[model samples]
Target: MHPELYLSYSSAFAIGLLGSTHCLGMCGGISASLSMALPVGRGFRFRQTLLLLAFNFGRIGSYSLIAAGVALLSTQAAGQWAWAGLLLMTLAGVLLIFMGLSMGQWWQGIRYIERAGAPVWRTLSPLTKRFLPVNNAGQALALGSLWGWLPCGLVYSTLGWAALQPTVPSAALTMFFFGLGTLPSMLATGYAAQWIRSIKSHQGVRKISGILLILFGLWTLPIQALLNL
Candidate 1:
């Protein structure tokens, strides 16, 4: 990978990691609920773990699909107009800054974006219900995949950043790694909800993560200048 592209992927990963504290609060309940959907047995522990992994991987797959579509559209737009890429990148930077602020509880600007997605979620939310009382890993996975579209600022912001990548594959890969970065916290939410919540509630942790994300957003602003230098 080019150094800059590598940095982009790394930034995506970092955003997922840092922003995951919010994810715990947002998606944690659903994850824990899935655990209840699992059947009781001597193999319950193994089954629960498998289902959780399936659910999360499915969610990640959903993120990849969204990123792919965004990237395709952005790439096509840029092809038609050279300035489109610059415009998209700048928009992505602004979104990231908003996400960082939201994560830090310093602003609620991203909530508007979240609300804007409500109509889509209303459509998708019903699909998730169909898989409820998940009896198998497949059902859990499907439910999780559907849950990925749950109007999250962090997820949308990350997708926006991924869309700014020059290629579809790069954008897809960015979302993939970002999903991986979120796995730990999200997984913990199912088994260790209180611990994850404690981490999310810590002001110092949020502040530091927010600052890092804000800097990452700032870094994207001068991509062309940096490339030339």
Candidate 2:
């Protein structure tokens, strides 16, 4: 891959790893509930693991799908407007900064961006109920696919970054890797809810993650390139 594309993917995965505290707040409940819903029996751990994996597969699949859709639209717009691509990159950088601030509990302005997605979530939320009380991996998968649409500033921030990719597939892959970064936390949540919760609530970890993300956002901006020119 080109160095820039590699950097984009790496940064996206880092964002997912660093911002997973937000993920815990958003999707961890459902993940834990999936475990609790399953009956304790022989092979209980296996079943729980299967269901969680399925759920996350579906969730990550949805993220890639959304990224593709957004990249499709953005690429078309960029084709017509010379400045559209740059605008998207700038927006992505700003969103990342906002996300970092929110992650650190320094500011919550990203909540407003999340609220912008509420209407979409409202339309999709009811569908999740149909898959509740998940009995099988398929049901869990369906539920998770739906849950992925939940209004979230972290997801939106990453989506903005994904949109700036040159191609739809690249954008989708960006999100796919990002989802992978969150897997450790999501998987651990079902097995060790308290431990995961404590990590989410740890102020020191959050602050360090926030500062790294802020630096990343600044690096993502084109200011340095403009200055060099």
Candidate 3:
């Protein structure tokens, strides 16, 4: 992969990692419930792991699908209008900065963006009930896929970044890595909810993560590219 592409993927993953505290508040309950719903037995741990994996797999799959769809439209627009690409990148950087602010609890401008997605979530939320009280990995996966559409500023901000990628597949892969970065916290939430919660509640951790994200967002801006020209 090109160095720039590598940076994009790495930054996506870092966003996921740093912003996961917010994710815990949004999706952690459902993730933990998946484990709680399972029956205890000799292979309980194995089964729980399987279901969690399946659920997260589906969730990440949806993230990638969304990224691809967005990138498809973005790349096409950029093809017709050179300025569109620059505009999209600028939007991505701005969204990331907003996300950092939200993550740090310094500001919540991103909540408005999340609210903008509420309509889409309302349309999809009812479908999640069908997979509730999940009995099998398939149900868990299906439920997770729907849950991925839940209105969250962090996800939306990252989608903007992903859409800035040059191609649909690369955008999708960028999101996939982002999902992977969150796996540790998501998985831990199932096994150690209290511990994860404490970490999520740590203000210092949030501030540090937010600062790093803000730096990443600044780096993502196209100012250097424009300056070179």
Candidate 4:
């Protein structure tokens, strides 16, 4: 893999991991509830872990699907204009900056993007209730897949970066990596909710994360390459 491309992929992963702090606030309660809903048994811990894993698998799989679709559209656009990647990436960078600002508590701009996705989430959210008291892996999987559609600014921001990739495989891989990055935090939320919440509340942590995210957004700008030259 080219060093530059590898860096982008790493950035996607880092973005997900960094943003998982936000996920703690967004999905932490849901994750805990999901755990409690599991059937009690001798192997409860084992089964709970498996269900959590399945849930995330379904969620991340959905993300990969969206990334692939976006990449396909971007490919078509790229065919029409050689500079499509640059343009798309620039747009994504702006979104990341907004996300950073939101994380830093400097602005509430990302909520607008969340609101835009609310209609779609409203439609999908109802279906998730049907899977309540998840009894099996399949039910857990289905519920997580639906949960992926929940209105989330962090997801949308990382998704824009995923769409900016030049190829479908690369874009899909980007989302997959992002999901991997988020796995730890989500898993921790299931078992260590208080610990995760403490991390989420630390003002210094958010400030540092916001700064890093902003720098990452700047690094993706096409002008950065020009500046390097």
Candidate 5:
């Protein structure tokens, strides 16, 4: 996999920036709930920040793991581009479209894919309970990791790109970077997500993101051409 091409910063940044909206909707309640778990005190802000970081660390870790796994699996297709690459790219593109729709909350059925990982989510979900008090960073991190399994289109996109990787390391690295790409906005959303989501609501950002994903799908063909058929 060409990291330079497969996990370009532009795409990651776009996903990250647009993904802020999702952060507001998906993680807003969870983060707020974690905040409530904090002990009451003026210094609670510090505790909240730590909790936020832990949550993001867990989420990013999960994204990286999934990305790597998908990429590793795709390695089986190396040198078989005529069939495998075509199929991978096609599925990726289709997934991207569905994800885009799902992100906008315009389509719900696509989330059925989340069921594929449900058993794993079930295993991790229990860890969140241990953080009932969430009085410290460790528990926050655990809860975050547990929450990382939450269904998400952006995460799916990262995994989709990973599945396009020619090797496991490349796939993982690509997604790590992609996860890194999403950090700023998501972090900010954790803080000011309600306002951000409200502002974004009236805009056409979702529609534009969907179109951009369509363009990304089209971009795959030219990329394959550059890969020398």
Candidate 6:
């Protein structure tokens, strides 16, 4: 199976970025809340920062596991890797369309599954309560990890794309990068994401990002056609 160049292609560096416009709300909201919820103290800010890093670390770890598992399954799938490319293309196209609609305010359920991860989030979230009136950095970090379990469609879609990679390690790395890519925006929200969120409207962000996703989908189509994927 030829998993070269496009086979294990990186999506905009981090596949997660493509979904940022939509994720701004759910992830953004949670981050803002987490930042505010930190126990008040001179070290609150410092503790909050560590909390964010830890949360994302756990989150990316989970995503990597999922991506690697999928990649292993795909790595061995009947190949020329046609199915892999086809699936990526399909997902890209669907995401582009849905993101486009979502950007225009046509729908809001795109984030529903992100809530499904809430069961885990709920279990982990209460653990954060133990740290309230926030005493130490470790507790804040644990809080972030608990919140990181948040269900996100963007994360799920990116995992699917990574799974399409023929090599499991590449898939894991791809997800790791994707997670890193998202860290900036998410972290910003954690500390001060509200400022950015205030300036830009989700619809505006979605419309613009939606177009980018469509172009990405188009780019994948040619690869699919070449492979007859």
Q: Rate the local accuracy (lDDT) of all candidates.
A: 0.86, 0.91, 0.89, 0.83, 0.67, 0.63
Give the CA lDDT, 0 to 100, for residue 11 in model 5.
66
Candidate with top lDDT is 2
In model 1, state the lDDT of residue 193.
73
Model 3 residue 7 CA deviation (Å) reads: 1.9
- Which candidate would rank higher by lDDT, 5 or 6? 5
Q: What would you estimate as the lDDT of candidate 2?
A: 0.91
Pull out the clashing pairs in model 2: none
Q: What lDDT score is found at residue 37 in candidate 6? A: 73
Candidate 2 at 217: error in angstroms? 1.0
Per-model tally of clashing residue pairs: 0, 0, 0, 0, 0, 5
Please write out the lDDT profile of model 5 over residues 1-229, one tens digit for every residue: 3446554545655665665555556666676666666677898777778888887787777777777767766776656555776667666666666766766667865678766777887777776777776777787777776777777766776577667766677666666666666667556655665665665575477677666665665665435554665
Off by over 4 Å in 6: 1-15, 39-41, 79-85, 104-149, 200-202, 222-229
**Global lDDT of model 3:** 0.89
Q: Rank the candidates by lDDT, best first.
A: 2, 3, 1, 4, 5, 6
Q: What TM-score goes with each of the models? A: 0.93, 0.96, 0.96, 0.92, 0.81, 0.73
Residue 42 deviation, candidate 5, in Å?
A: 4.2
Candidate 4 minimal-lDDT segment of 10 residues = 220-229
**Candidate 4 lDDT score relative to the true structure:** 0.83
lDDT of 6 by residue, 42-92 (tens): 988877887677666766776677778777777676365555566665665
What CA RMSD would you report for each candidate?
2.5, 1.4, 1.5, 2.2, 3.4, 4.3
Residue-by-residue lDDT tens digits, candidate 3, 1-229? 8998998888889899998898899999999998898888999999999889999989999999999999999999999998888888888888888989988889999998899889989999999989888888999999889988888888888898998888999999999989988888999999888899999999999999888878877877899777776
Show model 2 residue runs off by greater than 4 Å.
Answer: 225-229
Q: Alpha carbon lDDT of residue 7, candidate 5?
A: 44
